[model samples]
Target: MAVDLGQFDHPSWLTVAGTGLGYALILAVLTLTMFIVPWLVFSAL
Candidate 1:
């Protein structure tokens, strides 16, 4: 199940910039959590 966003192009640079930052932030958080949880549990004695 998915909702289509239609077009991928933006009308201006501001929108593109904002979206790029938002995507990066989301990716960073997901990646950090994915690795951190395992490391934390494995290292804890």
Candidate 2:
């Protein structure tokens, strides 16, 4: 499904940039979390 950017209030450029940054930050956090969780659980055992 496609979003209708023509109906939104935000400028297209800012929307694109913000979405990219948000995805990148989320990906980094998940990657770090996956690596740290295992070590933490093992250490507690």
Candidate 3:
């Protein structure tokens, strides 16, 4: 039996742009956390 692929289609540029922005934001937060956590631990000593 053949499996049916639903009506999914390519996303618009807006959707693609939003996804890019989300990824960038996630990266920025992770980078900041890496720097901040080390400083906080050392400062507390």
Candidate 4:
């Protein structure tokens, strides 16, 4: 069942931008850690 979107107020530009930036930063952190941890462990040899 699809919910009605029109019933809710649309997000403002700042709200949308903030959400996008938040997700991007979180993804970047996870990606960086994924590579960094392995590199550190392997380089210790």
TM-scores, all candidates, are 0.61, 0.56, 0.55, 0.59
Whole-model Cα lDDT of every candidate shown, in order:
0.83, 0.88, 0.83, 0.86
Shift in Å, residue 21, candidate 3: 0.2
What is the full ranking by lDDT, best candidate first? Answer: 2, 4, 1, 3
Candidate 3: deviation at residue 17, Å? 0.5
Candidate 2 Cα misplacement greater than 4 A, ranges: 1-10, 36-45
RMSD of each: 7.7, 6.5, 5.3, 4.9
**Poorly placed runs, candidate 3 (over 4 Å):** 1-11, 40-45
Worst 10 residues of 3 by lDDT: 4-13
Candidate with best TM-score? 1
Worst 10 residues of 2 by lDDT: 5-14
Candidate 4 accuracy as lDDT: 0.86
Q: What is the lDDT, from 0 to 100, of the residue 23 in candidate 3? A: 100
Per-prediction tally of clashes: 0, 0, 0, 0
TM-score of 4: 0.59
Ranking by TM-score: 1, 4, 2, 3
- What lDDT tens digits, residue by residue, belong to model 2 across residues 1-45? 989867766688788999999999999999879988888989999
lDDT of 2 at 29: 91
By lDDT, the best candidate is 2
lDDT of 1 at 25: 100
In candidate 4, position 45 carries an lDDT of 89
* Superior candidate under lDDT, 1 versus 3: 1
